[model samples]
Target: MLEFALLVTALMFGGTTLYSFGFAAFVFTALPAETAGPLIRRAFPYFYLFVLATSAVAAILLIARDPISSASMGVIAVTTVFARQVLMPAINAATDSGDKSRFKRLHTLSVVITLAHIGCAAFVIIRLAGQS
Candidate 1:
């Protein structure tokens, strides 16, 4: 179970890092703006869903052995839910309405949430690795 948790945490960390740094960048760089923007927008919900599922499972797995790590994973799961359900729609509304300021603020919040999730996943992995 511990090993399962560790593996999931590592995969979550890698997925976020790669999507943020590699895959998203590659998409934007390789594709035209009209194509890339909508493509990324379409992908964001799935990305959030992935984060939510993995984090929730990791949280459940760690709850028995490490409360601290489990709590962090729980936070990631909850925040991803918020990002997917609330923030993403708000962001789209802002964009659709031509509310540039609102869009920027919401987008920044989304980015910060994603970064925090990534950091927490990395922390959980490091903590688990040190234990064994």
Candidate 2:
């Protein structure tokens, strides 16, 4: 049961990570700036909520099952999710509404942080995968 729970948590985090990457790719590549604003506005809130809920559940499951092995991953997962899903979008939204320079700076920072989060998630997933 513990293994199963861990696997489920991993899958949730992995799936959310993939989904976020796909969305980020779309924002970076296909979408025009005009469309990007509207698209992000429409999509980000729901995505944020989804990530938050999933990460929360994953963390709870991890803590309930095995604290030592899973807790680190859970912490990383939660942090990544919060940054990608909550903080970035909020910053982006603020930038969109405010000064161009500020927007660019915030966007750049968000992108770098988000990429780092993805890397962290990937590392956690790989490590946990081997363990389980």
RMSD of each: 0.9, 3.4
TM-score of candidate 1 against the unseen true structure: 0.96
Report every candidate's CA lDDT.
0.92, 0.62
What is the lDDT, from 0 to 100, of the residue 117 in candidate 2? 48
The residue-by-residue lDDT of candidate 1 on 4-123, one tens digit each, is 999998888999989988989999999998899789889999898888889999999999899999999999999999999999999989988989999999999988988998888988
User: Backbone clashes per model, in order?
Assistant: 0, 0
* Per-residue error (Å), model 1, residue 84: 0.4
Q: Whole-model lDDT, candidate 1?
A: 0.92
Q: Candidate 2's residue-wise lDDT over 42-113, tens digit each?
A: 776666556555545555666755565456555655665766666776676676678677677776765675
Model 1: CA > 4 A from native: none
Report residue 127 deviation for candidate 1 (angstroms).
0.5
